[model samples]
Target: MGTEHRTDEHRTDEHRPDVDRALKADCASCFGLCCVALPFAASADFAINKDAGKPCRNLRTDFRCGIHTGLRDSGFPGCTVYDCFGAGQHVSQTTFGGTDWRRAPDTAQQMFAVFPVVRQLHELLWYLTEALKLRPARSLHSEVRGLLERTERLTGLAPDELEKLDVAAHRRDVNALLLRTSELVRAEARRGGKDRRNRRGADLIGARLRGADLRGADLRGAYLIAADLGGADLRLADLIGADLRDTNLSGADLTGCIFLTQPQLNAAKGDSATRLPPELIRPAHWS
Candidate 1:
């Protein structure tokens, strides 16, 4: 999916030296599960309408995207921003013993059903991994570790078990832990600051926040679509689930920002001057 071309440097978080390499997408080792299992609508992001369990029109016989090098130019920009969090490879290899859907038609439906479930679990793994790295959240580290291990075990469940998993409930439990971790980290970050406003779930769509002092701001789940956040100081801000599509991040400092994923950056507008977290790579389309 989105992380197909990521290099070793981009796949890791240096803060967590023992970060799981399998948490990053390895498209070469995958069965192109994202291309076949997920549905997409015709919009600014995708060029055609696709249904779940149907392979994308551009998917090749060998389970690779035909327009891999020119997906954006070919009007499949949506594919470029999709991160399966390494679920594709895990399902293709571990879940199915490296048997692709094409070879074992009988398993195709179950494979597709299990992919999304495992994907959600992997996303939780990513966040929990980062949570353990936050020094300010040290007191909660043991709890985070326990959940991380539990989530990892969930990903390894049989396809049948994975299909029947109550992923939403599991996500709720994990999110509660992450929320506590964010509070601890942000409190440490804003210890001496007065701008401790809690903007959790705020609707800031297209708002002009240029050069704003958002350091340590609680922006969890904020709708920032097309917002002009250029030159803002977002250090240590909690950005989990924030809609960043076309949001201008030019020259903004996002160093140490909590829960910011690569797909979020890929969907936004940024530039050379934007200070990103060490684990994330700058999108190529940024000016």
Candidate 2:
């Protein structure tokens, strides 16, 4: 994938689309591939050790987690974040025609292999769908849309094709769109030329603060959990001890956020979409 690109142009005010088009649990359209196809060690994030291709002991015969309603309480928080990006449903219904992994035991391994591939394609879809909503990236929306369509089509390919999926190339294409998105959002971050600060314990939850300038601010001990910080500017801000649990930092600029250590974030929560600086491990709690 390509590296970062900087540009000057404000387009954050354009009407972005709602991203809920992506799939959720819709068990009727999926085979619970994630629970069986992925491996997890016995840890705080999972209740038991399960190897790749092995279904969790708690997985019901009907393809639902036996502990679905209590995954967090049962030490399987990671299961809560295992979104298939609609690929699980696509594979279960469209590509494989609603085949059950159990009934067709012969295709089990193939299904396992294709699950991750479809997942990558679907994750890219999430990003492209999000990029399309960026008004600032309007100049590149056509290209972004093209990539989204192509990536979406790949998710419906045969198991053989999906097994050989070129996810890296698709990621490169999505990164191109994101570069444009960053340029558009970052331009808005430089507005007003007035550095703003928020005090501790401020109620910033669920605030639509995309692309806002927040450099050099004191957000220490702030209650910013679950805040919509996508595309927000956090260059050189003091994030020490800040409560970032569930804060959406996707595509947001944090090139030089001060005191933003990995442990602090590991103590919080985030997803695969979050773009953290190097040397940071994804917070284990995010799952």
Candidate 3:
């Protein structure tokens, strides 16, 4: 998702100056890498099928979407929910030094190949940065910081080096660390309670869970698509990789929830009553 100007209230401790600016999408400073480097099939979310390295038809000469304001109305809702975690600008300006694929035609293939790799690394940086801000995960801060720095360095590597890097192996290492952080934070939230739900990777699609008590729940990688989660108490829940598409989050309290990204919120349904972590803004479509 493109970055918006957030007020002071939206700037929480997780959004400290050190890493906040680096983890947000800045479309103005980018060369529309996402529109050209990523492929999308003609499904419910996209109006047309597009291949990697080929610019979307809506892309303008200035590298902005021609139908950005009416993306959803024009049958390109998927574009509204995609976030590159700031990799687009980093790749366009830093990796390739502001030379767009159109100008440097010879570098087009390598630039496309390197964008996704940097996107993944930047995502891990997002998680590691948040993990460092969790007071309950204080003991693991040093390790998280180390990994965050290493991931930042990886993002700055030359395109060829990044293409050859084993990102999957690196992701495994980062996931393990994040799991430990999740355990520490969730344990603290459920210290005096006995209802510790371990629904990690559970298939709860279309389940009736309105008004459910899901505080401190381990819901990592759960398939919660189209689930009724209205009025649920989801504080401190581990929601990393959970499919929240079309899920009802109206009136649900997601304060302090871990690993909840803007794209996930954009895909789900919510209302003004839904409470969110300070770092994330309510999606405009939620209204």
> Candidate 2's residue-wise lDDT over 1-287, tens digit each?
01133331322323224333454436656898888899999876677899999988888888887887887788877676555657788778877888888999998999989888887776666666655645555887778778877876787788899898788887877766665565554454446677565454687876777777776455656777778777777764556446766677766666544435443564444455555543234654454
State the lDDT of candidate 1 residue by residue for 1-287, as single tens digits: 21223232212332344445878899999999999899999999999999999999899998889999999999988888899989999999999999999999999999999999999999999999998778778788889889998998999899999999999999999999999989888886677868678888899999999999898899999999999999999988999999999999999988878999999999999888888886788898888
Q: Give all TM-scores, in the order shown.
A: 0.94, 0.65, 0.94
Q: Give the winner by TM-score.
A: 3
Residue 6 displacement in candidate 2 (angstroms): 29
Of candidates 3 and 1, the better by lDDT: 3
Mark the 10 consecutive residues where model 3 has the least summed lDDT: 1-10
The whole-model C-alpha lDDT of candidate 3 against the native structure comes to: 0.89
Worst 10-residue lDDT window for candidate 2 reads: 1-10
Which sections of candidate 3 miss by over 4 Å?
Answer: 1-16
Q: Model 1 off-target regions past 4 Å?
A: 1-19
- Residue 75 local lDDT, model 3: 99
192, model 2: CA deviation in Å? Answer: 3.5
